[model samples]
Target chain A: MNVFVIGIGLIGGSMVKDLRSLYDDIKIFGLDVNKAHAEKALSLGLIDAQTDYDELKKADVVIVSIPVDVQLEVLPKVLDHIDDDTVVMDVGSTKLKVCNVVKDHPKRRNFLATHPIAGTEFSGPEAAINGLFKGKTNIICEVEKTAFKLQEKALKIFADLGMRIRYMDPVAHDKHIAYVSHLSHISSFMLGKTVIEKEKNERDIFDMAGSGFESTVRLAKSSPAMWTPIFKQNKENVIETLEEYIMNLEHFKQLMIDDNFEKIFEEMQDTNHIKEILNGIIVNA
Target chain B: MNVFVIGIGLIGGSMVKDLRSLYDDIKIFGLDVNKAHAEKALSLGLIDAQTDYDELKKADVVIVSIPVDVQLEVLPKVLDHIDDDTVVMDVGSTKLKVCNVVKDHPKRRNFLATHPIAGTEFSGPEAAINGLFKGKTNIICEVEKTAFKLQEKALKIFADLGMRIRYMDPVAHDKHIAYVSHLSHISSFMLGKTVIEKEKNERDIFDMAGSGFESTVRLAKSSPAMWTPIFKQNKENVIETLEEYIMNLEHFKQLMIDDNFEKIFEEMQDTNHIKEILNGIIVNA
Candidate 1:
């Protein structure tokens, strides 16, 4: 099996790491626009060799793991080169734009739109780790649009990688992801900004920040080059989540101003149900 | 050494858990307004026995780990009962109010104001775990106000527990804590609220939420009984941090509306410095 992984960053590099250990006959190729990242991934033993789009035609499977904005330009070209039996899948965070970009393509049936909800705050090829997708949810957007044979091939790969699959429409995937993923990054980034603006003494933040603050602000360390495009692609839904989040913060502040400790206490008590919800995630994950 | 844990909850329970392992001569006592919690702590071996305020006169060290509002009411009474040699320390998140309330007390020299920057989302005696304070920061406020001998006793305990100590004025501690601690809770709770409100289907959150969302919203599961008092006690500083946080969110939203991806990218890029800052915390932690 000839497999090509485009954009050899955390996601793509990690996928190949798992794939190499899972299969013996497979030859994994890394295709990155950044030559340094490709070399780094190769040196890290994340791939068999480095290749580009010209050789994509030989790929039995092409995994598109670039930033969402870049996927808009690159995915269609990827589909243009693959064989009729070849399967192409994208692991972008936002799904609607990419799904729409290839909705009317000649080989539309060969492509799968997926988002494997797994990653750390760090980025780049060096950040990749084995088993990143294991026990993590991989949302498949518009899976029915892909050819049955191609779908089966992708599903086998995901199964081998230990990913739980959930299917949803592209629009709903984008909206739901805005709430679960995109909004988290924004809230975290803004929280970091607010703290940095106030605590000019970085030493104070280091000394004073507890585990709660560390966990909450961890996402602020994500790569902007990757996230800016996700926020752009899912602008409407991201803005909606942001507005609701801002309003919620404002309402809590008002409760504080009114000296409504009773109400403030009630609000936190109500949100405590997230504990039970997150427990299920941990078990499933 | 006789030690009395006045709250027998996560913090107090945890303190005794470590203290018990470190000192063979120490006999730990639990005192709680809730009889069940005191009994639970006794059953869990978090305390050697259950005791009350009348028994406080015998305590060599009284660790107050209750809500800040309750501390305002119960702390002075605690000081009145302790011996001149006994050290009464309150581990509430807020410091200024508690410090002022005991400022003129007859046994003020026996009181120590400290906030140990450690804990999980869970609360109560069962939530207590050994080594919870290991390598964590303990902020001691108004140390100069305490007697030198009592300070040595408290600092020794902190050091023995593997906690790094830092001294600060109560006013400055409250203000700095608002940004790093209080504001993170508000942001996390509000993020959980925003998502819970939008995703009426709880399963959506359970399935769609990734590690980032989980970490960002983890504090939403914290005990309101504990946090409400902390926010109320540090009202002015918490409010100031909230206003700045809300402003930053509003600004980010406007940038989204204006399609200013450049500025959004730059904003996150600038905040990426939090990575280095947080690395220091992880190292020191």
Candidate 2:
């Protein structure tokens, strides 16, 4: 099988690395707008060749792993070049916009929209590693739109990578992802901004930051080029989640200001349910 | 020298374990309102004996590692009971209120108000581990109020545990801590609450939650009993930080709504300063 991955950043690079190890006969080709990333991916042996759009026509599988905004522009073009036998998939965070953009395409049935719920804040091909998708959930949206054989091919590839699959509508995927993923990025970025603004002395942040701050702010280091479009693509859901988040923060703030210890204590205790929820997911899954 | 730790929970228990491994002749006594916690600490060898508060008088050093609200109520009494030679210190998050409450006490000179910039979301004696404080910062406030000899002794002990010491006024400590630590807890708790509220299906959250959600919401698992009074004590600073955070989120929301990709991208790019700041602090300190 010939696999071509565009935008050899973290996710794309990691996919190539993990897949190449599993299928030695897989001929991997890389395409990235950033020449440095393409060169790094080659040096790192993430792919067998650095190819262009024309080369995509020969691919048995094509993976578009660019920023969400770029994915909207590049995905259609990649789909246009690939034959009916080619299985095209995208690993973008927001699904609705991409799915809608390609809804009427002649080869739409050959494409699958998936989001492997796995990533570190780090980006680019150098950040890729094997086993990233292992034991993690991969959400596939609008599966009914894809041809049965193509869907089987995509499912087999993901299952071979040790991923559990779930099906959902693109719109539902965007909404759930806004709450679980995009909002986290915004919260973390804002936190980093808030602390930086208040604690002008960067040294103080370093001296004071513990594991809590580190973990909470880890996503702040995420690539802006990658995330800016995700928030833009899922603006409505992001806004709703942000409003609820802000209101929750305000409510807790007011409770604090009033020194209503009883209410504050109760609210925190309720939220502590997250412990059981997280533990259950981690231990059982 | 004999050391007595009041409240053998996460912080206190970890301190006893770390200190015992360092000092061969030091006798450590444990006390916890939770009798199970005291017995567990004894069994874990975190303490030589499970003793009573009346025995505090014989302690060469008495460490009060209790909840902030409880510390305000019990620290004074502990100070009253300790011998003139006993160095009494409380490791609490908010320092201003506790420092002010103990300022006029007759035994004020024997007490040191310290905040160790170290902890995980997990609490209780079982969470205790060796070397929890190594390479972490220990903030000491109102040192002038502490007897010079007692202050020296406290510094020596923290140094022995491999902690870097920083001195600041109680007011500044509380204000800075509210932004750095307390604000993070609220952010995490509310993030968890918002997701739980929006995604009623816990299974959806379990499947959708990646490392980003996990890291951003990790502190939601913290002890409410430990954090409620912290917000209550540092209400003003907490309110100010929350307002700034909410304002930033609102601005980001507007940017997303407007599709002002340039502004959104720039904002996140700027916050990327965290990489440099955090890395610098980690490398230098």
Candidate 3:
């Protein structure tokens, strides 16, 4: 089987790493707009061959793992390039935009919109490693839109990688992810920005950063090229979530201003439920 | 030598765990307002015995690991209760307030203001684990205020636990910590609150939380009992940092609302410098 992985960065490179090692018979190919990433992926043994989008014609499975903005433009093209029998899937973060774009396409049955809930703050092919998706949640939005055979094939791959698959509508996927994923990124990024803006001395940051600060700001190191698109693609949900986040922050600030430590303490106590929710996740780290 | 550990929660419990294991001669005693915690600390062997504030006279070393607000009210009393030869120290997050309160005390030389930059999101005795302070930074504020013998004693203990001690002025320590530590907690609590409020479904949070979300929100699980006091004690610096965090969030939100993804991307790119600083620290996770 020939597997074509597009945008061979962290997600795509990771998929190739796992899939190639899992299936000895699979001949994996890589396609990335960044020539250096394709070269890196090939050299790192993430793929058997470096190929172009035109070569999508030869793939038995095509994995689109680029930024959502690029996926918006490239997914349909990749779908159109592949034959009906081929299974096309995306590992994009935001699903609604990509699913909506390809939903009307005649070859929609061949495509599956998946958001694998796993990643580190780092990015690019160099940052990729094996077992990145192991034991993590993989959300397959609009799975019913996919053909049965292709879905089974995708399921087999996900199973081999030790992912727990969940199904949801693209609308729900977008909204909920804005809360769980995108908003966290925004909060972290802004935190790093705010700290940098306030501290002035990077040396102090290096000195004073505790595990808590490091953990809270870890996602601020994520690839802007990747997340910017996600934030923009899921603008409304992200905006709505960010507004709520800001309001919560502002209210907490007021509590501090008013010296209402009791209320502030109560608020965080309620949010401590996040511990239970987080415990449910299988961290790839 | 005797060690009296006040507030038998994460910090004090962890300190006792390490101190007892490291020093066979050190007879550790515990005092906590929460009886269950003191009982649990004794049961877990975190302390040799559960004692009370009145027992301060019997202690060779008094370790105050309570919340900062309580520390303000209790520290002077503990100092008065302990003999002049006893080394009294605090492991509170905010040092300036605590240090200021004891600056003019007759036994000020007996007191050491310190903050160990180590913790798990979880709290209380059960959340306390051995080696929480290993290879982490420990901030010692107003070191000059401590007697030479006591400083040597505390430094030896920190060194025994493999802590890299950084001496800081109490004011500078509190301010820098506000940006690095306290701000992270607020951002995380607010992020968790916003997500919980918006998602309105616990199961969805459990299903959708990625490692990024989990890391960013991890500190939200911290004990409000512990943090509320720190926020209240470090109000000015925290509010300043929180305001900066809010402004940054609002600006990012505006960028997203305007579809100015390019600026947002640039902003995150700039903040990615956090990676360099984070990489400088050893993450115990």
Candidate 4:
């Protein structure tokens, strides 16, 4: 099988590593707008060669693994160049915009809109590792719109990579993902900003940070280029979730101000349900 | 030296395990309100025996590692019973309340109030592990009130355990910790609550939680009993920090609602300072 991957950053690079490990005979071609990242991916042996969108016609599968903003811009162009038999997919975090943009494409049936629910705080080719997607869920949005054979091929590939596939409408995917994923990134980034703004002494943060703070702030290190578009693409859902999150924080703050120990304790205990929810998911770390 | 640890849960049990490895000949006694926890600590070899509060008087050093509310209730009584030569210390997240409670004690000089900025979401004797405190900061509050010899003895123990010592006033410690530590816990717990409440299907969370959501919500699994009191004791500071956190989230939400891409992108980029601060700390996992 031949796979042509664009972006060649963390997710794209990691997919190359994991896929190559699974099928040594597979040919992987990398593409990136950043020349340094493309060269780094090649030197890291993440791909057989650096290729252009024009060469995507020969690929058995072409993956748009770039930042969400770029994915919207380049996905249709890449699809236009791919052969009718080739399967096209994207691993962008936001799906509604990308799905709508490519809805009227001539070969729209060949494209499978997916958001593989897996990643680390790190980015770029150097951050890629084998088994990055193992046991993680992959949300396939607007799957019914894709050609039956192409959808089957994409599902098989994800299955081979040890991913559990979940189907949803593009709008639903964006809304739920905003609550579960995008909002987390924003919360972490702002928390990091608040701490830095208030605690100007970096030494104090380094000295005082425990595992709790480290884990909570981990996503703050994620690529701004990647997340900014996601927040923009899923703006409505993100806004709704962020409003609820702020309201919850405000209510908790009022409880604390009132010295309402009973209420605070009850709130924390109620939220502790995350233990059970988290236990169900396999943490990649 | 003889060391007695009360409340053999996560922090206390970890302390015992780490201290035992540092001081081979040290005589250690464990005590807990929960008999099963004490028994488990003993079985795990975290201490030489499951002992009583009275046993603390015989020890050269006593560590009251319990919940903040319990610490405030018990630490002063523990001080009353300890020998003049014995150094007593309580390792609780909030220090101001505990310090003020024991301020007028006859043996106030024998007590050293410290907060070791290290922990995991999991609690109980089973969660204890060796080297949990290594390379972490041990914040000592109101050190001037502690006897010079007692402070020296506590410093040696922390040094032996490979922890860095930092000094702060109890009031300042509570304030800074509210932002850095307490707010992280509250944010995580509330995030978990908001998502769990929004997504009626718990299975959605299990299916879609990526590394980012997992890291941000990790502290939601913390023991409610342990954290409830810390929030209560540091209510004023926690409320202030929570207000700031909510205000920041609200501002970000407005930007998202208005589709202010530039502002949102800039905000996230600004928060990337966490990468530098985190780089300075040793993240265990």
Predicted structure 4: lDDT: 0.87
Off by over 4 Å in 4: A283-285, B283-285
Tens-digit lDDT string for candidate 2 (A1-285): 999999898888888888998887899999988999999999999988899988877999998999999888898899889888999999999999999999999999989999999999889888998889888899999999999999999898998888999899988999999999998999999999999999998778887777788888889999999998888888899999999999998888788777788998888899899887887668635
Question: What's the DockQ for every one of the candidates?
Answer: 0.91, 0.79, 0.73, 0.73
lDDT for each residue of candidate 1 in A187-212, tens digit (9 for 90 to 100): 99999999998889999999999899
Which segments of model 3 are wrong by more than 4 Å? A282-285, B283-285
Range of the 10 consecutive residues with the lowest summed lDDT in candidate 2 chain B: B276-285
lDDT of 4 at A261: 78
Candidate 2 CA-lDDT value: 0.89
lDDT of each: 0.94, 0.89, 0.87, 0.87
TM-score each candidate.
0.99, 0.98, 0.96, 0.96
- TM-score of model 4's chain A, to 2 decimals? 0.97
For candidate 4, lDDT tens digit of each residue in A1-285? 999999888888998888888886799998899999999999999999999877988999888899888888898899889999999999998888999899999999999999999889889999998888888889999888999999988888899888988898888888899999988888898888778888988777877778788889899998888888888888788888988988888888777778887887888888888887887876532
Q: List the residue pairs that clash in candidate 4.
A: none
Model 1 / residue B133 / CA error / Å:
1.3
Candidates sorted by TM-score, best first: 1, 2, 4, 3
lDDT of 3 by residue, A1-285 (tens): 899998888888888888888987999998888888888888888888888777888888999999889988998899888988899999988888898899789999999999998888778888888898888889998888999999999999999998989999989899899888888888988898888888788767777888899899888988888888888888999899888888888899999889887888789889888777776664332
Candidate 1 residue spans exceeding 4 A from truth: none
DockQ of 4: 0.73
Candidate 3 residue lDDT tens string, B1-285: 899999888888888888888887889998889999888888888888988777889888888988788889899999889987899989988887888899899999999888888888878888888888888888898788789998998899889988888888988998899999999998988888888887777778878887888889889888898888888888999899988888888898888878897898899899998887787775422
Candidate 1 local lDDT, residue A28 = 92
